[model samples]
Target: MPPSPRNLDELASALLANGPVKTLPAAPKRIRVRLGGRYVADTTRAVYVWEHAYYPGYYLPLDAFAEGVLSYPGSGGGNGNGDRESGYALATLSAGGVSTDRVIVFTRRGESGSEREDGNVLAGLVRVEFAAVEAWFEEDARIDVHPKDPFKRVDVVFSARPVRVSISGTEVARSEACFHLYETGLPVRFYLPVTAVRADLLRDSAAVTACPYKGEASYYDVVVGGVDGLGEIRLRDVVWYYKNPKIECAAIAGCLCFYNEKVDIELDGKMLERPKALFS
Candidate 1:
């Protein structure tokens, strides 16, 4: 027995897959993809599906076709344009439930353009339905080098800005450094080693956060830098330190954290504005 016509679900699936074949987008429903004053597929009736290389595409039915539009140039006759001979012919079809209005038929090679362009012809070639086209979703996240630095570069400038460090009511350090970034849209965290900071001034805090760009970070309290007292200098979870970042951002493995507004940042002795968030 001959094979049965593809079911609704199977037909829909194939149409979506064929939408973005090698490069072009699946035939759109509402838009006119007229190569010769003929309708191919209606985007409105089709459903978009997923695939590799390209993306999800619009799928249309086969029965609602109007007639010949595509012309297969090559399989046999020596057409002047190599590309022309290899392509197929197609036409638009009217929607009729299972046989949607978006349907179109593609002709096989070795067929005449005049013969194949009309859907009424081509009793031998296979029918591949059109599907609704869908766009691919991209991954976007913030990365901080302080979390991970697999690159192993020293002084990696993920981002640069001014930062203020205060303890006990008085500001202790203010400097401008490139806040290394691990991912993309996170804060430009500065990488300061333990030695650069005064150990006696820091107090343990239980603040922590995870970054897709970086790794994980621990928090600390500014207990003794300024002369006034502990109450005068309080940065709640403002300071962060990356424990073991990737190799590229190795310089700021165990530094401290401070908000730019609280400190005076200077680059080459000139004060600089607070750096914006890595996401911005």
Candidate 2:
């Protein structure tokens, strides 16, 4: 005779190394993480689990997150029971031939454990904001930031705006969406999308770079307005081409990038500063 469902705990204990009722470590009192532009995660009221697959993953209390930040990208249900958990939300970011999405798996094992003295988890919960992201595949696959890693911060910040590029009297491109970066001080580079500027404006340059996070990237020379009047400007190359990207950066492949501190950047439609160093 087979055992009844009432003996499920006994079966789990006999079949698995850990008992059926496994107690996870005390959830993290606080975890600070940098995602997108802002710190998407900063809280002490949630417990996080180490994700075993893909990049290092982090889980949070479903209620700790700001509501309405997630949506299903496909026809799948918005909330469903996971393999072990009861319910959770999932979100996706896709562009070109690449994708990097996440699932917010939730469980009601012990909601009362996260409450504060005032009988409110709301006050203890952190504020979260959702912002639209581009499917820029090259940037995501090519760069990795180590928050606790101890190396000289290679990041740089651009203080200018409305960056302008031109050759002779013809303008190539200009935009105010420039980035003011703060990072490990290696080489401050800007990975721009091909669509953000003019099309077919870059010619292949004989240069390549290697990163610990991503693979090798080739180089390109800027062809301003069909001719090279400002000389040859070479940008980093692509390491691996994702024909379809999961983020907003899909149009970045085969595009010309730049050293933020080395180039002539314009602020509010005026030339302001130049790069502090030139590696290539």
lDDT of 2 by residue, 99-204 (tens): 2353333322223233333322121222111112321111123222211222223332444455665544445556655443344544444444355555566566
What TM-score number comes out for model 1?
A: 0.36
> How many clashing pairs per prediction, in order?
59, 35
lDDT of each: 0.40, 0.36
Evaluate residue 43 in candidate 2 and report its C-alpha lDDT on the 0 to 100 scale.
47
lDDT tens string, model 1, 170-267?
Answer: 55555454454433433344554465456665678898775433457787766543456743455565557888854555556776655554444444
Candidate closest to the true structure, highest lDDT: 1
